[model samples]
Each structure stands twice: as structure tokens, then as C-alpha cells.
Target chain A: MIVWTLLEWLAWGASGLILAWMVADALRVSHDYDEDVLLSSREGEMIMDEPHDAA
Target chain B: MAQAQAVTETKAQPIGLLRVLGPGHVWALGVGIVLVGEYMGWNFSVGKGGALGSLIACWVIGLLYTCVAMIDSEVTSTVAAAGGQYAQAKHIIGPLMAFNVGLYLVMAYTMLEAADALIVGDLVVALAAGTGVEGVDPKPFVILAISLLALLNYRGVLMTLSVNFVITAIAFLAIVVFFLSVEPWNPGAVLHHADLLAGLPYGWLGVVAAFQFGIWYYLGIEGTCQAAEEVRSPARSLPYGTMSGIITLLIAASLTWYVAAGLLPWEYLGQAITPLYDAAQASGSTGLQVFLFIGTLFAASASANGCINDAARAWFSMGRDRYMPIWFGAVHPRYRTPFRSILFLIPIAVSFAFTGLLDQVVTFSILSGLLGYTFMPINMHLFRKRWPLGSIERGYVHPFHPLPAIVLLVLCTATFFATYLGYGVQLLAMMSFYIVASLWFAFHRYKYVRRGDQFTMPWPRPRGY
Candidate 1:
């Protein structure tokens, strides 16, 4: 069995951190984009409602 | 579709990037741009450092790429322009630096595209030879490849990414297959090769030399940011795509090295153009060999197509900014794509492809890449000073502030010098580009700096956009 050196371990750890960040960010953005779509639709509806209310 | 058509016919809004891409699409582009390396070319590192040294170099390069990606994500999200690093450098640093970055980016992407076109030809010829197919010159196929990629790019961004996603997916799966096909670990084999001294054949110097090929593992990750304008939400998706893409590349690169080297001797693998296929063939799997041959073709296609998209976008941005002729800024009246710029690159790339100067082109690509990378640290620092936290809404603020960028700058600088020492004459082609750009800028200062054109900005969307 090949024993990993301290530097190798550190490299793995760093890569681990990046991978974790990637996953977390992907999930976060997926959720955020959903909310963004919902909010944008609501905003559009509000713009439509303004004309109706004025009428 | 009717509304889009009507909009197109009435006024045909000026050349602008379509916002049809999402994080996933950006991820595909990022992955596709570098997929060529995982399947081939990177094995050369083993010749320099053996297995262990090359692995170490890859780790360091991967870290540098991670840091560079993070910094780019932060800057890209905040700026959100098609110009990408060039725009950021312009806003934060100065025009001179921006021009340099823009030219460097163009050079990197063009050289990469040209190199990939040649590799596609080379791969097809090699495959034909192995399969007992008859004689054929690869030059026509090379031209056909470049023209085909240009046509896809000119069609639309959506088509480009869709094709990129499919091919990149295959390339990654091939890597996974390669990993799976490797023989089960033998403690005795590793013990017998103890003379490898933990895989470092020539020691630390070898590791330094290995940096050249090690960078291939993540050379084009930063290009993802160039698609910022087309992304649905740049602030969020840029980081997501770029960071995830970096992780995917790291995994693919490591597996590629381990499985290929483990199955075959590092020395033999070092000289292989189709290392992954060679490794799979070593496993006695005709099925795997054929699969890899097909995968190599698609991988080259994906890299070339994605790179042309990036190069055209950068040139279009430069044209819009008056850094180059406005003819490059022309968008197709009906297609709403940068058709002129895309077509313009075909001849230049085909010329380079026919020259058969893959080594010089790769050297030039790396030299320009390092130049652009060295500017990122400076851009980040200046950016933070110009727009501190909470002043502007941005995504993925890199922790520890300047450290990541600083480390990236150091790595890029060291690699630049190393590359120069190793391939100084070849890199003169890249230096010559800078001299030419300088001369052009000196003569055409007014056009290059006159600033009425509005580029996409994150906050307070630029007027006329």
C-alpha cells in the first residue's frame, strides 16, 4: 500500500473543499433560480395589476 | 417562436448574447473546453516527472486552478459581461492591461481551437490506421472539422451548448470507464516499483518541469466566465458552473493518470497521443478501445466548438469596445449571432491547423494563458478596493480575500518563466503578438479607447442593453 505524504493529504483536503463548495453552490443556485423565476413572474403580474387598478 | 421572429424582423436588436444558458450549460461549456486534455496530451507529464512527480504537479496546478476559478467567479458575477476578464481588467486595472488580457484571451482560445482541429485530424488518421482503413490526407478533414464547428456556433448558443453537453458527457464517461477497466490493485506491483520512490522519478525539478503538461488538466476552466452574459443568472451560475467544472476536471484528470499509468508503464504512456485508448487496449478490451476512439473524436469536437464560441465572443467584445475593427462586432441580421466574427476565425484557425505546428501552438497557448492568469490577482485586489462587500450584490465571495489570487499569481508567474526557459523560441510567437497589438494600439489609440458602447454590467444595467 502506498502511504500518502502530508502534502498529498493536504492536496486531497483542498480538492475536497472545492468539491464540497461546488455541490453546495449548485444546490443553492438551483433553489435560488427557482425563487428568482417565481419572483419575476410575481413582479410581472404586479405590473399588470397596476394598470388594472388604475382602470 | 412567433414573438421572437417578430422581434427579429422589426428591428433585430444589435448584436447581443442571448440569455438562454443556465448553470448547467455553463458547466458543460467549462467541461467541454478542457475535455481534450483528460483523454490525451496530459500523459506527457509522466515523461518529465514519472508518475509521482506528475501527480504532484497536477495537484498543485489543480489548486492554482481552483483559486483562479474562485477569483474569476467573484469578478465575473459582479461584472457580468461577455468581455469577461478583459472587461474586469479594464474596469479595475486600466485600458492597457485590458487590451493585453483581451489579446491574451483571443490568442489562447484561437491557439487551442487550432490545436484541437489538428488533433481531431491526427486522431482520425491514427484510428484509421489501427482499423486497417485505406489512405487519406487529414488536412481536408481538419478544415471540415473547423467549418462544422463554426457552423454550429453561428447557428445559436443553445445548439452549441447542447452539442457541447452531449460530447462532454461522453468524454467524462470514457474516463470513468477507463478507471473501471484498470486491473484490481496489487500491493506487490507497487512494492516492486518502489524504485519509483513514491512516483517521483527525477525529484522536485522534475515536478517543476512537469508543470507544463500538468496545467493541461485545467487549462481552459476560466473560459466559462466568458459566457457570463448568456447565463440566466451570472451572479449565481458562473460560480456554480466554474467551481463544479473544476471539481469534475480534477477527478477526471486524477483518474486518467492513475488508471492509464497503472495499466501501462508511465514511460510508454508518456509518448501516446491517444493515451486513454492505449490504456484501455492494454486491458485486452476491443470494446473499450473502440469506445475510446469514438470518445476522442467527440472530445476534440467539443473542445474545438466550445473554444470557437469563447474566441468569437471575446473578439466580438473587443470589437464592440472599439479595441478592434467594428466589422468583428457584426451580428447576423436574422440569426442574431456573431456570424462575421465566427466566420473570420475559420481561415485563421485553418491556416494554423495546416501549419502542423501543434507544439508551438500549445506553447503559445500556455504563454498567453499565464499572462492572463497573472492579471487576475491584481484585478481581484483592485476590485475589492473599488467595490467592497455589500456595496454591490455578487455571488461566491472567495474566503481569505487576496490569498487565493496571490497564490494563483505566483503559480502562473513561476510556470510562465518555466515555460519560457523550456520553449523560449516557440513562445516568441506569442510575444510577437503582444508587440503587434502594442503597435496597433499606439497607432489607433482613439478607436481603441473611445468609449460610448455599453457593455453588460451587473448593477444598474447599462443603458441601451
Candidate 2:
């Protein structure tokens, strides 16, 4: 059987916790991004808001 | 009347760089360049440190990057320049050091772009061979892909970043699918399989040997900072983008290791360049295997695209600052992009890609990265001392003062030595490049730049601009 070392366990745990934190942050930012877009649309002139076609 | 005039004046100035990026683009650039780590190259660690030992090495490297990303965030937020590390080095260490740092980074990015270009060629042939077609020459296809990406990049930053964002998403999804498709696992079986546990035969020495591959997991996470100049708000987007990218990669690395190792004998997997495809093949889904093969191409292309964009930016920044030829700083009147720098990058990458020396090129790239990172900790301490908390417009100051920077520097130093010992005489290429840079600076560069407005040597005290 493969036995886990303390270091290995800690490493795994850190990865899990960090992953959770990142996912939560991503979700929060995504929501804020949508709201910002909506607000900017209402106010007009969102700064480079349209896509460019040329160099 | 004054406020109205100010708004009109600001709008009237010629648009520079089309500043269209946000946190998402920054995250995409960082994750896109490094995503290939989870797809391939990292399995080589299993050859040196066994499954368990390699996992440990991954943890150490991951921790080092966590510190690097955070510290780099602070630097990017403060400087907010296209030159990235090169720009930060200029303000802190002076022009001579900035020239070397910029040159090394440019070389590293160019080498990576060439290496990924070659990998995309190899994967195309592999995909064809999977369908019983054989002997298709990959050179033309590789050349085509490189040209197309360069042209797209030249057109606009929007094209470059939009494509990267989509491909990066697909690449991540491939990993998830591959993970779920893996065979049912037995933890006991992993230790019992001698082939899967090859690195265990050598003990701790094996773990030390695994450091380079461990680094692959998060190698290019800092590439985002290169886009600080393009972001709408560097102070907010840089840290958010970089931190999210690092943490996401950490998870992807762990789960990838777990699933790939658990599903197949790592000895066989370690030798496979496209480990995910091989693992999918072993999982008995030829369809998924074929899907992953295509995803591998996307992953490599995404990385190469990001590298090309970032490398050109470095060259542009250097040229603008008169560290190199000022002509290289020329922006396209139409695109407003650094057309000259991109033109320079293409020939170098194409010529190198044709050499078929990607393995050696990768080593040199790693050496450049290690050297570049050495400056971070010192800069961090210097920046903190100069502009202590609340004195400057900073984002995400690394907590616990200098401890994170100190740890990252120690880790970078150890990895550099380990890499030197591993590569040995092969690293003469990097040394020669450094010597060439020094000679250029001493003989021709200094005199030209000394009179220019860009020269910031004789390190000035912080003016709190």
C-alpha cells in the first residue's frame, strides 16, 4: 500500500484550498464584471468597448 | 468649462496601444503560456522522482510560484509598463541590469515560441499517423501555423488575446475530460507497480533531480505581467489575474498528476510526449484520445501565441528605451502595434524552429527564467523599503513583509544550481548569450543610450510619481 508522508499530505491540502479560493474569486469577479458592463452600457463610453478590425 | 476642456483634450491625444485588456486577458495570457505544462513535459518528473516524490517536488515549485506571482503583482501594479520585469529593473537596478534582464526574457520567450511551434508540427503528424496515414512532412504545416499566429498577433491585441482565451478554456476542458475518463484506481497498485514507481529506486537524490520538471507545472505564470501596459487598470487587474492563474494551475497540476499516474504505468507515460493522449488511448476511448490529440495542438499554439505577443512587447519596450536599436520600437501607424518588434521575433523563431534543437532550446529558456527571477526578491525588498505601505498606489503587497520574497529567492537559487548541474556544459549557450549582451552594452550600447532621455542609471531616489 502507498503510505502518504506528512509533506505530501500538506501539499495536497494546499492545492485543494488554493483551488477553492481561486474558484470563489473567479465567480465573484465574473459577477462584478457583468455588473460593470451593464453599468457602463447605461452610462455610455466604456473605453475601447468595441472590437477592432485592423492593426 | 475647465473640466469639459480636460475631457476633450484627453480624448484628442492619439490612441496608443488600443488599451483593451482587462483582468480576463491577463489571466488568459498567464494561464495560456503555462497550460502546456499540465499537458506534457511535466511527466518527465516521474522518471526522476517516482509518482509520490514528484508530487512533493511539485508542491515546492508551486509554493515558489505562489510567492513569485504575488510579488510580481506588486511590481506590475506599481510600474504598469509593457516592459514588465525589464521596466521594473530599470527603475530599481539601473539600465545595464535592465538591458540584460530584457534580453534574457526576450530570448526565453522566443525559444519557447519556437519549441511550441515544433511540438505542434510533431502532434499534427502524430494525429495523422493515428489514422494509419504515414510519412506526412510537418515542416510546412509548422511554418504555416507560425506565420498565421504572427499575422493575427500583428493585426491587434484583441485577436491574440481572444484566441488565447478560447483555446485555453478548451485545453482546461480536455484535462477535465481526461481526468474523468481515467481507469478506476487502486492506491495500493501504484506502489506495487515497479515501472510506475521507477524513481523510488534512487531515494531522495531522485527527488532533487525532479526539480526541473516540477517547475514545469507553473513555469510561465508570470507572463501576464507583460500585459500590464495594456490593462485598463494594472493596480487591480494584474494581481487578480495573476493570482487566479497561479492558483488554478496548482489545482490542474495536482489533479493531472493523480489521474494520469493512477490510470497507467508512469514509465510508459513518462516517455510519451503527449501523455494525456497516451493515457486516453490506454483508457480504451480512441475518440477521446483523438480529441486530446487536437487539444494538445491548441495548447501548444496558445502558448506560442502568448509567447510571441509578450516577446514582441519586451523587444518593443527595450527599443523604446534605447537599450537596443530605436527602430525596433516603431509602431504600425494603422495597427498601433509594435510591428517592427513582431517582425524581428518571427525570423528568429522560424530560424530556430528549423534547427530541431528544441530540447537544448528549452534548457536555455529555463536558465533565462531562473536568472530573471533572481532580481524579483531584491526588487521587492527595495520597492517596499522605498515606498512602504500606503505611500504609493500599490495592489496586493505580499503579506509578512519580505518573507515571501526571501523564500522565493532561495527556491529560485536552488533551482538555478540544480539546473546548472543537470545541464552542465550545454548551458554554455546561455553563458555565451550573456557575454554577448555584456560586450554589446560595454562597447556600443552605453554611449548611445547615455545621451538619450531613456537612460535611468545612477539609481535615483523614489519621487513617488
Candidate 3:
């Protein structure tokens, strides 16, 4: 019984750590520079003097 | 000159299966093979407890999978595509969510291919142990098997389905025979008494623990939707196949559990790595073991081959949409199949097998799948409002108005959390891997579009009824 409890806890603990990492990664991406800004910067450099349609 | 050139380019031959399966049969075969193998393995794990608690855990998880299946059916029917969950989520949510789901699915399927390869290897080693073939390494065998399956898929979907049909029939029969042959019909054992509950080592947590095992049985239910394009009369076939697959799995699982429990004391179940094999031995029916071995081999082969066929098509679709490289979308000149993608999967699957990471692969696959499943109910809710069901509909409506979808959402969220908690660092590492890969690909695609890079291929439009 003790062994079983230990194994279960170990499994849970390992999973928790992974979950935390995933959440942290998601947060980092969300906090980074706005996607639109990044997109416009790249677009401006490439399509200078040319009419760009949004649609 | 221009007119002649255009005519020649437009006359490309169709690659892969034209229309061998009605949606219903494809659904049945897809759901049936995976569920049988999954339940057999899971029951072996749960049946060891011989306690009432484990039995209830098993049944509850089974019920959860049924609910998930119904939700998947609704979503798939509304947004039928080769991309399966990715397409459904994209339609209901947005492109970003769809990209994430697709990314996760590709990772999951790749891992699944590896895990199936490992199972094939393990089964072969076990079978060869008694034979004179001594000291056989299963790695080479696994690699060989996956390679062969990839080649079969590269040939076309019709050939793949034909093989799947034969294997699925044998596997289904084996399950029926195993259930019937077990002594003393005792469905009461599943619900009766308290001492049985105490046998599960996880105590209160056993419920969730058993859920992982139970849900595994219903893992491939969504495969039917992935093959919707190749299926004839998909509208009628898809729904019928989805429902039939779920019902068949439910019946098979219940009967297998009941008979296995009645035949042996529950305590011994866990100790026997292969419960059915042990059961066959005890019954003095040695032939049954051979039957099961062959059945499992076929089941594993069919699943791996079917998955390769389905996954390659999805990659092709993604490529056609300009979401992936044109090379992935390219068809074989003679075969008309997505030969490039099929060839690519072989190495990835083989690499996974060589790494000896079957458990990790399976866990990650399940976790990703559950995440995909969370979006299913949401899609169904949106779809129901947009396109209400007709009076002729025969399926049971989810009770409590919007509550069913809401409940599934909560349940799936909880399961995801539980999975992360259960897998710990491994799950974290995998998620990070997926996020990085998805972002990179998304950026790459954006760059390609911004450059006015002509795809040269025809854009895929949604097929109308």
C-alpha cells in the first residue's frame, strides 16, 4: 500500500512539473510583441511602394 | 501552345482509393480495431485488482469515452475533412487554434505510429520466446513492419482498407470468442461489494487512474472522420459509422470485462501481463492463444497502416492549402498517392521506435488527443445553433440543453490538467516542443504567403453536399 501511494504521488508530481512548463511557455508567447506589429514590419520592408490589399 | 499546356496539366490522374467505404463501415473498422486492442490491454491492467472499485472506475471511464464519441460525431459530420480535429476546431474557433490542434495531432499521430511499432515488436518477442528462434531483437522487426505499412499506404487507400477489413473481421471474432468461452457469466461482479474497491492501490485516485486506461480503448474513434473524403455518401455514412463504432466498442468492452472477471480471481489479473493469454492457458485451449496472437498482430498492422494512410492525406491537404511545403502535397506520377509524406513518416516512426519511448509516446498522444477532444463539444454547440437537427434525427440529444457540452468541456479540461499532473516533466517538455514547432511553421507559412510565392497547385475548397 505504501509503495503504491509513493508511485502515484511520483507520477502526479512529474505531471505537475510538465504542466507548469507548458503554462509558462504559453505565457511567454502571449506576452511577446504583438503578432500584428510583427506582421506589418515584415510586410512594409517587402512590399514598399506597392499597394497591398487587406482582403 | 498555352491552351495545350493548360490541358495537359489539368489532366492529372487521381491517386489513392476512389470510394471503397461507406462512411459507416470506415467508422466501424477504424473504431472497432483500435477499441478492441485498447480494451484488451486496459482490462488486463484493471482486472488485476479484483475489487469492486476498479470495476466501477472502468465502467465510468467507458461512459466518458462514449460521451466523447458522440461529441466527435456531431463535430465531424458538420465539418467533414481529412484534417479531422484540426478542421473542426478551425471552423468553430479560428486559424490559430486550428493550427495548434493540427500541430498537436501530427505530433500525436507520429508518436502513435511509434507506439504501435513497439507493440508489434513486444508481441513478436513474446511469441518467439517459446519458439526455437533465440535472442531475436524486436527493434529491427518493428522498423521493418512500419516500413512495410508505410509502403502499403503509399500504394493507395483502397488497398489499405481492404487489408483493414480482413484484419478487423478476425480481431472482432477473437474478442467475441474470448468473451463467450470464459466460464460463469457474472455481470453482477462489476457492481457488487466493497472489498473489491480496496484492492486498487491508488485508493480514491484509482478512478482517474483507471480512466486513462479505459479511455485508451476509444482512442481512434476520430479516424473515421479523417477518411471522410474517401468515403462514399459521407453525410449518411459518417454519422452512421461514428455511432456504430461507439456502440460496438461499448458492447465489446462490457462483455470482455464481465467474462474475464468471472473466469479468474481479480487479484491475479494484474500479475498476468497478458490476461487473455493466461486465460487461454488456464482454459486448456492453447489454440486460442495463437488465435489471439495472430488477431493482435493483424489489429496492430491494420491500425498502423490505416493511420499512415490517414495522416499522409492530412499532410497532403495541409500542403495543398499552402500551410505546408508543396513537396508534401505532391502526388506520385503513377500511383497518384502522397508518396513523399508517406516516405517521410517511415523515418520519423522508425526513430521513435529506436528511442525505446513507447510509454512516453502513448502518454503524450493521449494527452494531446484529450486536448483536441475539449474543442469537440464547443464545435458541436456552435454547429447545433447554426444548423439545427431535423425531426428525422435518430440520435439521443445531449440532456440539460447546453449542459452536456459544458460538462464535457469541464471534464476535458480536468483530464488535461490531470494528465499534466500525472506525466510531469515529460509533458512539459513535449508541449514546449510542440509550441516551438507550431510557431516556426506558422511563421514560415506567413513568410511564403507574403512573398507572393505561387503554389502552382490548385487550392482545396470544402466539398459541398
Highest DockQ: give the candidate number.
2
> Per-candidate TM-score, first chain only?
0.53, 0.51, 0.54
For every prediction, compared with the true complex, DockQ reads 0.02, 0.03, 0.02
Error of 3 at B283 (Å): 3.0
**What does candidate 2 score on TM?**
0.83
Query: Alpha carbon lDDT of residue B46, candidate 3?
Result: 66
lDDT value for model 2? 0.74
Pairs that collide in candidate 2 are: A55-B334, A55-B335
Interface RMSD of 3: 19.8
Comparing 1 and 2 on DockQ, the stronger one: 2
Write the residue-wise lDDT of candidate 1 on B1-465 in tens digits.
765555434332222455678888898888898989888878788888888877887899898899989999998887777768887886777677888898888888988999999998787667556657545456756776786787778767888999899989998998887666554356334222343334577777887888888888888889998887777778898999999999999999888877776666777876787788887787777888888888888888999998899888888777766678765665443344566577677778888888998877777887888888888998888788777787678888989998898899888876876576578776776678798887778677545556544333434422233
Q: Which stretches of model 3 miss by more than 4 angstroms?
A: A1-55, B1-17, B43-54, B186-201, B263-268, B385-401, B449-465
Candidate 3 docking DockQ: 0.02
Which stretch of 10 consecutive residues in model 1 chain B shows the poorest summed lDDT?
B7-16
Write the residue-wise lDDT of candidate 2 on B1-465 in tens digits.
765554344333333465678888998899999888888888887877777767877898898899889889987777777778888887776777788889878988888888888898787677667667666666655666677777767767877998999998898888877766553354443223334544464587777777777887887788898886778787899999999999889988987787777666856766667777777776777778767877788889999999999999889888776678776665443354666687678879888888878677777777787778888888888787776776676767777868998898888877766676678675676778798888889788877774445533233456464
Against the hidden reference, what TM-scores do the models get?
0.84, 0.83, 0.76
TM-score of chain B of each: 0.93, 0.91, 0.84
